[model samples]
Target: MNDADNRPVADHPFPRFSDQELARRRRAVHDLMEEAGVGHLLVYGSDRSGSAVPWLSEWPVTREAALVITPNGDDHLLIQHYNHLPNARRVARGVEVDWAGPSTMSRVAQLLPAAADQGIGVIGPLRARDHQLLSESVGELVYLDAQYTRLRLVKSDEEIERLREAARFSDLSVAAIIDQLEPGMTERELAAIVEGSYLAEGATNHIHYFATTPMASPDTCVPAQFQSTRRIEVGDILFCEISAAYWGYAGQILRTFIIGADPTPLFVELHDVADDAYDAILSVIRPGVHARDLVNASAVIEERGFTTYDDLVHGYGGGYLPPVLGSSSRPNLPVPDLHLEQGMALVVQPNVITPDQRAGVQTGQLVVVTGSGADSLHNIDRGLGRIG
Candidate 1:
């Protein structure tokens, strides 16, 4: 485990968690099971979305996969799609891998203990049909999705290192777009540039959203959740929210760019307010800081008569974990009564948009909470981006 930790990440054809790190995760999950009085834990995933499958077995769930954890440390991992078996076996650590066959839930039900004292604790996004199957097979089915999310809030040392690598890849993606953006290029081309930067480096796209509009007569504020075919034009503002992942760990960054011209006065003001709000929020991001404190710091944006379209701050590096907060001007979710911890990572974006929702700017990156303050994992320049 020590040797693997010390070796360069590029040396491994596929990234892996060290044995020690895997053991720690198993122990933590076992503790959770004990607390919940569940004899077994079934971590399920489909279409590669659930964070728990990869968090436990290091096999990022592809078509479908489920990790059944028992107290005896003899865990069984079932993978769907016969072709995905080889890779799952190669990458999954500390588990017995098998084919999940025609019915994934049936395979899971068969593997679970016939009788558990507190029933079966399940995590991940289970389809209603599968949920019913599991419930029928086992008398009680306890949903522990929220509890599993809480378990991922504070990262471990190895996890933090992986997050730093993810952040570097995210920075590279954003920088590639900034350097190659041209007036004639389409947003689809921009998306290609972002992925082209890091795909070869074994990083996958978590998300790359773009919003391009004429700065003179703006039409959009926040970056669209999906890319568009609209071509970039001179005097257009292009803002993006991008995250590139190394394995399942990912880094998020938001940046706004002006194509083929300098920013106008209004754009400058909007970006300045976003930058100030980013700084203000970061200033109070030490361990033990309440979630509301970060929101309060962002009051600068509203004071400057601007609003935000996206979340002001959100936990990152492990499934958008907790303390998802929005500015006072626009509260996305109830301000979570959560406090920052030393190893917690967050993206402090202040997507300051105009009150009329016609214009906005993106400016922020992923940062980890330290004992004294927050430390940015990304090295990209934090100034307003300009391109030709």
Candidate 2:
């Protein structure tokens, strides 16, 4: 009865969205900003990684780029480079443009006047680059980000439908990886298969990839050994905390699997404890429940024979919208009081460690809040994932 035995079932496929749908998502952003009393929003991107900039503007902001949404409902796409100006303009349909000089943030700062004078409530908080620019230009104009995030949390029916498809694809992708898993296979090799399968199935991103041996610290990223020559071996466990985008919605899926048996007693016991934790958490999820109470309830799993890592649950949405769900952070959870409401999506992952501290195990599921309870979008087998 090792904890590793109860792995979630995986069965889904890749996801895609139509152009009209993309446009609709952007419009929704504007509408939300207006409703929140935001005079203007300055959305910026510093890196090429996951960003809400693309989600809102429909354009990827690689360099110094920002999206300005005014109270009048008008929008603007500002960038430092002239070369990407065309690409930005192409992606921005109705939004105005303000290409600025690369060396200084002054040009972009000039746009903050309306935001400062009337005290524009910012949507997405300005990043380092843009924050510095704003400090110099607008000072502090009652900046805020909660309203914008709340609007995203309660997904529209269309958005829910898209997320459902993405979850389906995530499940299928994991199953495909499981089908490809075998003893002696390197972790890197397995990751490639997992990622490749997602693409072949039509996925554009590898939301995330985490795997490792039962006794090893969780592999949360693609290791470099993948390039050399490493392979999987017996007694190994493959765990994944990944997601994908279908249309404009996001699908988050977590999975765990084991290779050739000879299971450790601790692994078996903790894996089952992890299962109980997963089920317990799932049982209490529903609309009206405060995120903190959910975490408190899940804390009992530790009392029942398991150790916990991170929070028991966290909020999730398209891209990486935050106020991460659940009451698990420094001292206590910091997210403002928000009840689990129908249409809100979440990921409940409960990782367990043995009393001895030698082994750690976990099980997590992605679910959507319903009127009564919660509906799971991800369905991976919760028993020990065994390979022949």
Candidate 3:
């Protein structure tokens, strides 16, 4: 049971939440716990490199990581034993924290003994660890994979604003890459420009960068760090996808460009077909649409004249997914039938290829389904990009 007041606000760049906003979200989480009959909820954040915990708390949790929230409305954040200046500051503010080993079980017990003894419903990422800890510490404990994922799915007005800002930064990055389109520049150079632009636009510290040379043989997704050193040549085609994060929110984008000459007639035809298919998926997208149906529509694009990189349509937004959920990192292609509903954001991409041609068409959009239809967060050029 801790209260994190007087938390320093100067060290971080993220805008501190207005007292109103914090109250609103806090109330929302409490309400959700009440509805689910959860006496306490524990949220475990990624401890891996580039964790989003810092972005949320304005402080890093070191090796130890887990957030405990009691139904009485107390927030306790437990972390590993470093006890650096940042950790000390947070702990001093009554953030019921303890230093423990990285073992998940050790971390779980430190955060939930009281709740477990009281027979409170506990939900989070540490059931196994909780059980182990309980066997040694006190009473039996039960936990479900309870998470705030579904609650966080719908964005609040303030959250929506931050996401839009992040998307705008990504859009700016894309435009910068397009501006640098030329035959002589290396893919690495272009990637640098994109990342530099993102930073200049106040993007958060984490970044995922990738680029592709559509005209090259055995075209493959080149990671940003290892973008082909080979210089771009005349008539080279470029495709890039970047996932950007700001204030702990993330959005993905894809854009293509052609250098030295107009895309070949064949390329133009394929691009149009791909665009149409992307729109086709968009057309069927609305509240209550079945995710599998959207996947089926994407398949039609492949059947007509395109190649799908993979069959995938998962929601994306502020929170990164857990391992079990099929996400970009651990893709379980062709996910089971999931219903599409309002407040769910998705990326619909359909890459179409011709039966006789080696080249393929690719197009996609990030959209949010509304009651009436869908709306795009960023508007892409109808004609992707032509450098000629």
Q: Which of the numbered candidates is closest to the native, going by highest TM-score? A: 1
For model 1, what is the error of residue 295's alpha carbon versus the real structure, in angstroms, after optimal superposition?
A: 0.5
Better of 1 and 2 by lDDT: 1
Number of the top candidate by lDDT? 1
Residue-pair clashes per candidate, as listed? 0, 34, 6
Per-residue error at 284 for model 2, in Å?
1.8
Candidate 3 residue lDDT tens string, 1-388: 3334644544434445454555665676668667666566555544533233333343444454666667565566666555553543443332465544567556666566666445443444444655566557645544533345565555666666666667777777777766765677777777777778778666853454444454544254223435778787777666655656675665666665667766777667666766776777788888777665665555545555445443235566744431112222223654545566666667665545444435554455456677777777765564557765
**Candidate 3: 10-residue stretch with minimal lDDT:** 321-330
- What is candidate 2's lDDT per residue for 79-195, written digit by digit as tens? 757787765664444457657675435665677665665445554436677566676677664454555566578776666776777787777767877787777776667666656
Better of 1 and 3 by lDDT: 1
Off by over 4 Å in 2: 1-38, 49-52, 80-90, 97-104, 110-115, 125-129, 214-230, 319-336
Overall local distance difference test of candidate 1: 0.88
The runs of at least 3 residues in candidate 1 whose Cα sits more than 4 Å from the true structure, single-residue gaps closed, are 1-11
lDDT of 1 by residue, 1-388 (tens): 1122345445767887776887898888899998888888899889988889888888898999988888875788899999998877777777888899998888888887474555789998889999888888876888998888888989999999999999999999988987888888888999999999999989999999999999999999999977778999999998889999999999988888888898999999999999999999999999999999999999989999999989999998778778999899899889988988999999999999988999899899999999999999999889788887
- Candidate 1 at 93: error in angstroms? 0.7
Cand. 3 Cα-lDDT: 0.57
| C-alpha RMSD of each candidate structure in angstroms | 2.4, 8.8, 5.0
Alpha-carbon lDDT, every model: 0.88, 0.61, 0.57
Q: Estimate each model's TM-score.
A: 0.96, 0.78, 0.77
